[model samples]
Target: MAQPMAELADLLTRLGTWTTLYIDGPDGSPAPERDARRTSIRDRMLRAGTPEPDVEVALELLTDDGPPAPSSQTILVRDGTVRSSWTSSTPGRGSGRRS
Candidate 1:
């Protein structure tokens, strides 16, 4: 059986994908200004013939901000799991210049 955290991850993944489908404009078109990319693990999984539930579980584990740090090699263990890594910028630490 999977853990609660894993379950939450799966839900979030599905929600993320469904959210993307409801966005403005048709698929393959660029999102309008001020809009953000809403693609999710579910979208990728469907494209690669993977099960949505499995993809969700893997995304949950890979995104957990626990020790060891997240990385691309963090095997998702799903059929179409696309392993990726990202570095976010810290807020409030700008170049100290006026706009």
Candidate 2:
């Protein structure tokens, strides 16, 4: 737990504005549900002034092919590029913010 917190601190120390996204991927959900979520994410990112390139990259990371089991994803982007991202088996609600 300390190691993870240290890593997060390091990430926060980086210079430049950051866009962090937490998404609960639509694993067993319907196609429309997934599409709606994707659209919402895109809109939010754009509204928050995230670069188009970064938004596209983040969307790519959020993709799921209707897997039987659910999963969560976290995407970090800066200056129109994806800095880091990861997926986990735990379920999570979708959200995004810039700092």
Candidate 3:
């Protein structure tokens, strides 16, 4: 998401839409490194000049330890309502580079 967020900043600079990030923790619970990763992403987005009001972040933590979610999704929410949500069937897509 390094250059991508920067690219997003460029695209959203002249627009009023926002970009929200959800850090879904491992096993639905917060990872030990969750803070670090969240900080990194937020900082990168800000450094890229993403407008403060145009950026949002949320961390979804689980109630108990369990396996990772079977799927990853992109969800759009506005005014506390889901506008859209889609899960990718492509394996290892959200986990990052495989090789």
Candidate 4:
């Protein structure tokens, strides 16, 4: 099972507007900007050798572009609670999760 993203999530809502997305590329420095596409995670959480898809997803979400279409968002968590959820793979189970 997946664990709730708590501390980091808190930081996102309470402090910063963006989460650093780790990508496998030339390690990009963390750039703090008003937009979510400001930086990569080379300076903070992750280094090189991470998968590209995960990085892409992080960028898309933080960048406010939404997860790639046809992709079901399983959890929209805030401070360790489920705000909203939907899954193409698993239908009608959103009631089990809650904020």
Which parts of model 4 have CA positions greater than 4 angstroms off? 1-32, 35-37, 42-48, 63-99
What are the lDDT figures for the candidates, one per model? 0.37, 0.73, 0.44, 0.37
lDDT tens digits, residues 46-92, model 2? Answer: 99888888888878778574323456667888876877777666555
User: Where does candidate 3 stray beyond 4 Å?
Assistant: 1-31, 57-70, 75-99
- Residues 12-99 of candidate 4 have per-residue lDDT tens digits of 4764223233222222334543233335342232365434444444434433233333333333433333343332322222455465
Number of clashing pairs per prediction, in order: 0, 0, 0, 0
Deviation from native of the Cα of residue 17 in model 1, angstroms:
23
Which residue window of length 10 is worst by lDDT in model 2? 90-99
Model 1 lDDT on a 0 to 1 scale: 0.37
lDDT of 3: 0.44
Better of 1 and 3 by lDDT: 3
Question: Model 1, residue 93: displacement in angstroms?
Answer: 31
Checking candidate 1 for backbone clashes, the offending pairs are: none
Residue pairs with clashing backbones, model 4: none
In angstroms, what RMSD does candidate 4 have relative to the true structure?
A: 14.3
Against the hidden true structure, what lDDT does model 2 obtain? 0.73
